[model samples]
Target: MFSLGNVRVRTKLIGGFIIVSLLIGLVGGLGVISLKNVGKKAEGIYSQNLRVVYILTDMQANLERVRGNMAELIYVKDQAQKDELKKSIANDKEENTNYMSEFESINISDEEKKVYEEFQKNITQYRSLRENVIKLVDEGNFEEAEKQYVPIRKVTEPMFISLDKLININVDSAKSANDNIKAINASSNMIMMALSIIGLILAILLGVILSRDINKPLQKIKMFGEKLANYDLNFDFEVTRKDEFGQTGGSLVIAQNNIKELVKTIIENSQSMSAASEELSATVEEISSKAINIDEAVNTIASNMQEASAETEEIGASIEEVDSSVIVLSQKAMEGSNNSNESKVRAKEVKDSSKKAIEESQIIFNEKKNRMLKAIEDEKVVENIKVMAGTIASIAEQTNLLALNAAIEAARAGEQGKGFAVVAEEVRTLAEQSAEAVKNIQETIEEVQKAFKNSIDTGNDILEFINTDVHKQFTEYEKTGNQYYSDADFVSTMSENIAAMSEEITATVGQVSEAMQNMAQNTQKSSEQAEEIRESVNETTQALEHVALTAQNQAELAQKLNEVIQKFNI
Candidate 1:
């Protein structure tokens, strides 16, 4: 039920040509035939019936004239008038003779000819009587003229009868010819009506065929185009030959191929994008892990810094205490110097007590040196951190290998795995970064370990000197009043020095605790970022799944379309 206009123009054009030719030939040929029939009818009527009718009319007119002439001769009285009438009658006789000759030429039936001859004999008799009457009238014989008119009337009467009978036959023949024409007209009318019906039916049939030829293919193509536009490539258009429609079908096939190629390209691109996304996710995860490690390292450094800071603060506080103790010791030394004569033994004992106190201060300084040595043993902790970084680097390298393998697999899978290949590339980049981060962490750990070792060595040297000084101070404590003044000043100076060293150690400890808290906060942030990256990877994976399914469906549809096309034998 599709419109013909919607079909290929070529098909419609061909059909139109056929239809136009049929219509022209039907109408023109039939018209020619009808006209020929009319011509034949005209010929038949004119040749036979019309000719007879005209001849019969002439005979009737001749007979009527002959009767009138005979009557006129009967009325003439004067010799001169009678002579004129006789001459007129002679002329009428001659005209009748010519009419009789024409009637003989028509070749009617023997009976009809005999009737015509009898009428001619009557006319001859009438002419003879008229001639005798005419002669008598010339001789002034009136009675003779009347007798001749009577015989002439009798002779002319039969002529009128013969003419009337022939006229009747001519009328009947004319009527028969008219009836024949009517019959021909009836036949012609019937032919014309039949031809009209035939033409109409032919036109209808042509229209149906033409419409079908044009519209059916077009409707199919239109529906196929709609389906193609909707991305359904499973339809087949079976147009054969090298016509315009066939060319269009070829173009459609090409377009379908292009679409399939495009679909394949899209699948490849999607796979590539998915791969890149996964790689990025892995990189981000690696970065998060590295950040966490860095945070942990920073915490360790911060803890160490805090301890150093606390030690410095404690050193300052100890310096203040040592200054107060030195002030009290100096006061005691001065009081003992001033009260030397009042109690020399007690002064000596007080000097000994002062030396003991100074020795104890040196011992306490040595103990502080031991604590510093313990803190420096944290070098092993830095070494352990370097090992942990090496392990992470190894893991990152393994991840890189896995990504490379995945990329290879993606390439083998062709377009379907292209996205995975991209993701693999991103993963490789992240792995490289993780390895580099591990190297940096290792270097930092080495630097911290070297620094800790140097601090420990310095502390040991100071501790050895302090311990030796403490023993010497104790042994020299009882040596006398001459050296008492020099020893008292020396002991007081050593006590001040001990106090300054103690103050530096306490301040370093408080700084380490503050740094540790900051490190913990940064590690928490890194963990949160890792979780986000994992979620993104999951989404990418889902998208890749959808793309794969779509590609498979498209391939199936293409196969179906191929099968349908085969059915058309195109």
Candidate 2:
């Protein structure tokens, strides 16, 4: 026999419904049977008992009619009146006989049958007396017929009493049958109510029992789902019933075991990853230090180049001053032999100033050359910073990968690894921040490289301008020196040539001054560009420092994540 507990849920539910249906069917069947019995009783009361009562009432009415006609016969004297009375009485008698015959055909009680028999005997005796009165009335013996009326009246009175008795008996039987039907209806109603209450109670109790049996397992399943949602995978699913709940519990146990294995694998892998992250952090730090050193070397080279550019501008200014002195010497030479000594003194001064300017110009040329070499070195440093930016970006990408791996492992560990997941997320975020910082550093380095290139281009333009304009101006000053020396020699012999020489010398001096002003402007622009390059380098260096700091923070977060993941026993 299959126990209810072991049955499938569908079978149990179907069985419960069948039982309730059968109970309701039984109640309905009983009601139908009771109603059928009541119907039969009602048919008996209406068709037999009540029908007999109605027939007895008709008999009584006919008896009264016969009695009335017979009493009228005593007063009736004419032959026609007598014959009318006789016909009326005979019709009344025939109708009463028909009614009595109908009453006798009906089923009646013993007491009613005895009363009906006595009624028949009285009717016979009344009929005999009526016949005699009719015969006396026919003979025109009215007095004798009136004398027979007394005996006839006595016999008819008893017959009427018997007929009334029969009516009363049938009426009583009808009333008794109606009372029985009322009792049966009331009893059936009570029985139906009792059966309905019993059926309802049974249905409710069965429903409750079935519901509890079904819902108990469903509730357990619901609780299990809640536990799973809460990430509590530690509980045992011990249901052993051979039903749906048991099957579900068995599935949950399998899931729990699988989760346990996965978590164990995650813990082992996370431990190994943590060690790798530490090594990566150290490697990044070493790279950062080397980048810092390269930045310092670049800054030193930029500083030296700026100083050399300043000296070249000073030399150009000195050459212009020497040219102005030569114009004064020429003018004094044209003034005459009396101003010859003054011309000689001014001419010697111009020669000395020209020599000094030439020497300074040579020094300026050397400095400018060295500055160009330094600018080339700065360009190399810019390249190095760009390489460092790429390295940092690579390290940041590796860190992001490591963080991703840790987060995946933490997720596999479920509730036990939530703390680690948070830490991994922080590390991942830090890695993203580091990557963004590296990108900023790369952009800043690019800006610095652009500034360096501009500065280098500006320096080259300045060197080219000096090579062209300064060399031309220096050659013109040498020619002016030769003219001044010749003018000194010919001050007595060619005082007329001295005036033209003076005007020419003055114009050459003005040209030298203008050339010097242009050189000064070029130098100033180069200096400003150098300054901008220096600021850009400084910003790039700062950005590198921030990248290093972010890398250090990322390393710390990875360590923390590793430590948290290690705490899980798995």
Candidate 3:
């Protein structure tokens, strides 16, 4: 259920390497453990199983030597030679006793112990019969010594059978040890292979998922960029992943919508220009006919100029009064301009302070984000958690294996092993609990990492909003103040211009009739220019047609690009 979409690419790469390292470590650990088990098996054979067989075999050989020594005693007549033979037989008896003591101390099975008891009973009988034969020989009763020797030799048959059975038990134990070592080695290989395969599959799956996440968004952005280059702004950039590409694609979509609005504004302005050009072409024809009749209106203009000259004298007095009032209005306008300038400065100050605050907030937020990312990248606490989890898992595995070995050994001990089996079971239970705890710890760490990532993302979203939205609002507020100051200055300048124009009108009233006669002459000249204007209008119409064709082509191209972009989910 976990998704790779929101996960950072850097994390994916690091996780991939971590998975590989864990795999190699697990395989290596398994190899080491298998080698350790083999070593223990070899050591067990040498310390117990093989040792038992060697001791019992050596006891059998010593008994054969005792039989030889007993035969030598029956034939020897010299007392000194007889004492030497008796001493050799006593030495062999002492060695057999030592071998029997060593054999009894070993932890053997119940069946092997029964066989050992029978051998001990028969061996005691043989030793007693040999002692009787030796006493007879010492007293020079050769016939009685020979009869006791026959009985001594006969007693060894059952003893030899018991020795063989004891040796067989130890030999079988050695064979089982060898088998156990082989089983451990085989199981280790199989487990290692299985785990390695599973690890590789998981790693590959992660890589593929990461690749898909990256490639899908990248391809969308690439196509979106290509379309943008062609002036296409209608692409559906719907990539909603929380990773880098998603953010970039979302920004592109916003830019696209903004550009589309700008282009639409441009198209509207072009249409307005086309309409104004059409109106100008219609007015040009009316002006061409009106230019010929300018003489008729000149008389009317001359009569109005005389009336204007009479009124100009009265206007001079009114202009004096109006100029004073205009001066006062200009003074007030200047005051308003100054006030606006002060307000603009204050607004700029507020804007700068807000911008600084936003910038500082961004810096602090980025610094914290970087620190957290650095900690995660540098493996600060997460590394310790991973190491601790790995160690716990290793301990649990080793403890479980040890418990199983102990259980096997206890079962081999028969009734004496029941308590040890219970202990091994308890140890195994504790090991399983440790393994489960490690699993829980790992899961909790994963959840913690996800939580940390979400926190970082939320911080990023807040910072982005402040920079892109809040900052723009402050810029607009500053612009409003600037516009207010500009309007106030324009009002002051316009008032001064109107006062100067009033005086210029009083002087020019006398020359108005003379100016109209000159305009009549210029109007006659405009008749000739009107013909040229008509021809120019025709050329302008052709240019407008070309512009309309270009706009149509552009619209078609935009449509095609939109269709292509619409296919992407972004």
List pairs with backbone clashes in candidate 2.
Answer: none
Between prediction 2 and prediction 3, which has the larger lDDT? 2
Write the residue-wise lDDT of candidate 1 on 1-570 in tens digits. Answer: 664435567666676678767766776776687667767767766664466567667656765765665566556555576567657666766675676666566636555666666767766676677668767656756677776666666666776787777666656766775677677777767776786787788777777887676566677778878878666766666656354555777788788777767666654455455455555555555555555555555556555555555655565565556556655655565555444433555546667785777678677776877688667666667777888998999999999999999999999999999999999999999999999999899888888877887787777776766667755665566455436555555555565455454445434433443454345445444544544444454444454455445545545555555454334311
Ranking by TM-score: 2, 3, 1
How large is the C-alpha RMSD of every model relative to the true structure?
52.7, 50.3, 51.4
The estimated TM-scores of all candidates read 0.40, 0.45, 0.42
Better of 1 and 2 by TM-score: 2
Per-residue lDDT over 1-570 for candidate 2, one digit per residue giving the tens place of the 0 to 100 score: 654556788888888789878878877887898788888888888787778777777777777877788778878767788788878888887887787787667777899888888888887887888889888877878899899988876787777787778767767777887788788788878888897898889889888987887788788888877876665767667775777767877788788778767767765675565566567667656766766776576667657656766776677667666776766676566567446646666776777777677677777877987997898898898789889889988988998999899999999999998999899899889989989998998899889888888887887887777777876777677678767866766765576577677778778777877777776777666666666666666666566567656666666665675665454333
In candidate 3, what residue range of length 10 has the lowest lDDT sum?
Answer: 291-300
Q: What is the C-alpha lDDT of each candidate?
A: 0.65, 0.76, 0.75
